[model samples]
Target: MPHSNTSQSKGLALPPPTIVLVHGAFADASSWSPVIELLLERGHRVLAPPVYNRSLAADAASVRSVVEQIDGPVLLAGHSYGGAVITVAGAADNVAGLVFVSGYALEEGESLAQLQGRFPGSSLADHLVYSPYPTSDGATGTDVSVEIDAFPSVFAAGLDSTRARVLAVSQRPLSADAFGETASLAAWRTTPGWGIVSAADHTINPDVQRFGYRRAGLRSVTELDAPHLVMQTHPEEVASVITGALAEIG
Candidate 1:
């Protein structure tokens, strides 16, 4: 039998929200592989889409497009830049809640660049490498990626050095505009939210992550002793928090 949006067993009702996972810059949908396994084991429908790291608005629109195809309510989750994408895309009507795994939750009119600088922990500015790419109008646009040597140490410190090195080599770079674009809407304002704070994160300061989560009024917050790649380093922990978020809205 097909699963309905709501299920009844005994006298209680269960909410079956489709889980949509979004990855941040320097990554693709594969970043959610670990977490996907856990969510599926728990019987939740999950979708992890490729978010082209070109511009914030464009990435958000890509996420929105994926959400629109789902047949039921969604629990949208994002990491790093992915968090910023969901903040803009989560405004969709079918979105039920949001999960931020060491992700940014920018407010209206705020850019990820501005939010990262709000606190003093991130070393991203010092490690970034930029290249020029042709834009729609024939002018050049900046593409940003972290130095290969800096990736394992700065972005994935919580993971093994070998794995981090591989991730660094295969990482995707985001357009400079993605970091500078101001968010049009903050979905967390009206949607229930959950946050996973990577205590040892270097990409985005842990303090900034906490502030974003607090400012958004997240219903639940989990602090883990991990780095920016918290979802990868601590997938079970990340999944636990996501499960909690799902329970809250149900």
Candidate 2:
């Protein structure tokens, strides 16, 4: 399922594509600001909504709400945990393409637990992960979350000192329960998609991201010496990948 030839040209036509931004755990919608801005500047409409930001279902519902506002085809994109959220949200009729920014792609019968289980010692998760809570955010199960220092060390690994600090403070704490939800659909398998591999990422290992990229059978793939937050660490490069995907799917 690997892509054959990756051209920087145009292909199919989606309904004036509306790019939806879904942020991973410990972050809100603003996590995609730079990338969203880049795409918007390029004449595309962007929808970066603040999903439940913690509750997986709530986040998916937020994505659905945004999708409802748009008129046609959408390039639903998610970062980190947001990837899982979009997998469900994009199942709708209008999702034309998908983008995973150092995000996870769950298999039809798998959950985040099983996928991460495949890469237990990935440097990315070891450093950033916090212990699951007895009742995180009022939940009744184990819910591991991130702390401030680990947040930057893992997520903004490629960011400048200033930006990383800002991201740590701005990060939102998602409900620990979101990761446990089983992904009901294999969105990547059924949809055209692409992934941006952050070579220097600390939150999610570069190697692991590549695994997802390859397994998802992306239309095209690109790697960058960016942080886990490639959207913020390398905005233009991230946008260019999206541009590349748009061209291929034009």
Candidates' RMSD to native: 3.9, 6.6
lDDT of 2 by residue, 50-102 (tens): 76655666677778767766666678888888877877777766677888888
Model 1 error, position 55 (Å): 0.8
TM-scores, all candidates, are: 0.92, 0.83
Candidate 2 matches the true fold with a TM-score of 0.83
Model 1: per-residue lDDT, tens digit, 1-250? 1123333323444446899999999888988899999999989999999998999999999899888777667899999899999999999877899999899999999998899878885777789999999998999999999999999888878787889999999999999998789999999999999999998888888998899999999988899989898888899999888888888877
What is the Cα-based lDDT of residue 199 in candidate 2?
77
lDDT value, candidate 1, whole model: 0.88
Candidate 1 residues lying further than 4 Å off, grouped into runs, are: 1-15
